[model samples]
Target: MSHSPAPRRRIPAPRPADGFMLLLEAARDLRTVGAVAPSGKALARALTEPVRAQAGQPLDILEAGAGTGAVTRTLIPQLAPGSRLDVAEANPRFAHRLSELVRAHPHLAGRPPEQVRVHDVHVERLETGRRYDVIVSGLPFTNFSPHHVEAIMDRYLELLRPGGTLTYFAYRGTGRARALLASPAQAHRHRAVERLLAAYRDRCATGRRTAWANLPPATVWQLRRPAYAVEHSGTRAATAEGAGGAGGVPGPAGVPRTGL
Candidate 1:
């Protein structure tokens, strides 16, 4: 009697470093690495909504502070053909790993690897000449000083094309934790960043989403730059319509042990 043939199995996607890499990087620098675990699937989806919404268009996208390609996985598949993605990570290891992930990503099969670039630099230092239609940021804003966050935010807005959308997340309930676990001075720094973020949220925020399924949970905000945004080389001008600051923390301030 002839035995039945075994069924074929499909190849699966390669798993990137994910939590392991993020944890290692965090150990190196909690302030820069931020979280202990990589972003959850739910959180990744929430953070990438702007890129999803722009599907079918040849868009220019930027993913800042991408850690282990968590959100990058969700994003690359949604990019319309001919679209390009630039990833900025402050950690050299993460950046190198991200480059490898991008090279092997199935979504990039049809296009050259040049479509995706990983930059080992802080988001603020990325080249300014190129503007993006959508930006998904994974930076840990709460860990940073207000001035730095503001500068980064300004750079993000500056890099956006008119009417572009920016999406970013902060772990929920981090403020209270900071107040309890940190020195008064450190706590004060945390508070300052919160206030700065609040200012931005108040002005330009279009909407927010909560991802309770994540390791420490998170809130994603979508902010828009005014369609008519125009910057003169030198001028003391106010921001344009729909192009203001973002909103404040939605709930309890949290200092989460989660990674970007």
Candidate 2:
């Protein structure tokens, strides 16, 4: 009689340290890091739903504020052949880790080196000439000032191609919490940001979903750029102010204007 050997269980790559890193970064700057823990699996899934919806087609994706690459891990596996991903992380440490992850991702091993690129720069400052088909944002809009939020949102629209989708998440109860526990100035700022975002939502939002499984429940909002090119004077005013009069919605020269 012959004895059969047991099958070995595969061990996942080490990721236990991401939580600690997130905490450290949050402590250093809560405005940028926002949450103390990395995003949960459910949240990542909700934020990447647009990409999954466009499965089987090559897509260009941009992931902003990719702290610890939690969502990046989710985005990479779903990339179709010939697709490209550009990850932007403002934090140097997080950007370094993201670069390493992009390099080591198994799914990208056989793909061209340019298939994935990690940029250590703020998403607003990122100046890639190419537009994206999907933009997944992990930035904490609630933590930022109204001006910054408007600037970032404008930049996202500028980076997206017409008919492109943008997905982002906001933690639940944050507005209420700020109203109760934050200073008057903070609360006012939050309210201003809310109003600004509400305008964008009214103009472009397609759908929204809640991810209850996340550490702090979050609502993911999906906005689609209009398929046709049209101009909006209100958007032009907001974009000009957000860009500090540096001309409207700066991008690669000759990029067609897709007014929000």
Candidate 3:
């Protein structure tokens, strides 16, 4: 007998209670929460654009710092059959919430049980040998020190397979806002992070988009790994210098949750 393929799943509206819990978490620990509110639908869509572009092909995906699963909800439905998604969150509370989200998400109901997975540790500690085709990040780079940011970024590029994409967002006006209220030392840290990011942007950036419908407007950037990912000239030596190969993105000694 011949039969039609199952219809694609539609996204469900977020629940009020979920939003409330997210707000509470953010209030309790703004440093790890990233935003006071869950990622708006528009922003979620923007961040998941890379996955949509790879429709019909199986892929390995990673979503780091998924504070409340707003972005997770959008990402799961877009994954092609046989695709794998690993969500890494450092905060135990947020991680628990994400685990629940994965179990209850309608779109993931009939897929392979392992299609979606969550880790309660930092992204830097995720234990995986598979190279990812895409990585969607929700971490707040501005919250951590420059060295931490660099390590995280380096780990991300390393985990990606050749020509893979990495997407992430930063709240709009953060630079100006920080300059006005941050201490001189704090401001310096932000500058150092920016300079580090600028170097990568110059080398690997593909495109960027502004999502205005979010609480605090944000910009999403997409960067592609060089075609020769394993042998990129500049990064080859660095990746060899005792860098945590595949299972982890080693943190600087004494640094906790380096960038996730």
Best by TM-score: 2
CA lDDT of each prediction against the hidden true structure: 0.77, 0.83, 0.77
Model 3 regions lying over 4 Å from their true place: 1-13, 229-260
Q: Model 3: which residue pairs collide?
A: none
1 or 2, greater by TM-score: 2
What is the lDDT, from 0 to 100, of the residue 7 in candidate 3? 69
Displacement of residue 53 (Cα, Å) in model 1 is 1.5
Tens digits of per-residue lDDT, candidate 1, 150-183, equal 6788788788887889999989888889878987
Q: What is the C-alpha RMSD of each candidate to the true structure, in Å?
A: 8.8, 5.8, 7.6
**Which parts of model 1 are misplaced by more than 4 Å?**
1-17, 230-260
In candidate 1, clashing pairs total: 18
Ranking of predictions according to lDDT: 2, 3, 1
Of the candidates shown, which would achieve the greatest lDDT relative to the real structure? 2
Q: Which model is ahead, 2 or 3, in terms of lDDT?
A: 2
Q: Write the per-residue lDDT of candidate 2 for residues 31-131, one digit (tens) a residue.
A: 78998999999999999999999998999999999999889999989989989999999999999998888877878766899999999999989988999
Q: List the lowest-lDDT window of 10 residues for candidate 2.
A: 243-252
User: What TM-score would each prediction reach against the true structure?
Assistant: 0.82, 0.86, 0.82
Q: How many Å off is the CA of 253 in candidate 1? A: 26
Candidate 3 to truth, TM: 0.82
